[model samples]
Target: MSMLVFFFVPAVIFLTVVAPIWLILHYWTRSRQNKGLSDEERQTLEDALSVAERLEKRVATLETILDAEHPNWRTAREDDYRRGGS
Candidate 1:
């Protein structure tokens, strides 16, 4: 009975306390490791956003030019594109 109690007490304590603490720390560290983008990844994202903004500005300028030169240009081009007349 004493031998059984000794083994069982430690086994229960390990399972109930040590296991949960170990699991929590393991997952916590993993989450910290995965939390942020690397410098290269952040730079790539910034480059993509910059390019997108520039393209948007260019498109807006082109649309303004087209509006000045041909008022119904969008309607006409949209119709042609919809009809597969690119």
Candidate 2:
């Protein structure tokens, strides 16, 4: 009756406040424990990044020359506008 509801109300309120905090900490610890990458994996990532950096440098040099020659060449916004109306 009223006594039962009073006890149940506090229990529900306590659970509402505490459940999310408990679950968040639980998942955070689990993710840190589970998602560790090995040293070899990190080395592979560094190698891939180096290759990407070299390619980006080359593309940037080409873009600089293109920009100097034709400033408005192949702007994506202009291309999109042309395509949209046509």
Query: What TM-score goes with each of the models?
Result: 0.68, 0.45
Report clashes for each candidate as comma-separated counts: 0, 0
Q: Per-residue lDDT of 1-86 in model 1, one digit per residue for the tens?
A: 99999999999999999999999999999999989999999999999999999999999999999999999998999999999999
lDDT, candidate 2, equals 0.89
Listed per candidate, the RMSD to the true structure in angstroms reads 3.1, 8.6
Q: Which stretches of candidate 1 lie over 4 Å from their true place?
A: 1-5, 75-86
Local distance difference test values of all predictions, in order: 0.98, 0.89
lDDT of 2 by residue, 22-56 (tens): 99999999999879778999999999999999999
* TM-score of candidate 2 versus the correct structure, residues matched by position: 0.45
Off by over 4 Å in 2: 1-35, 84-86
Best by lDDT: 1
Q: Lowest summed lDDT over 10 consecutive residues: which window, candidate 1?
A: 74-83
Query: Which residue pairs does candidate 2 place in steric collision?
Result: none
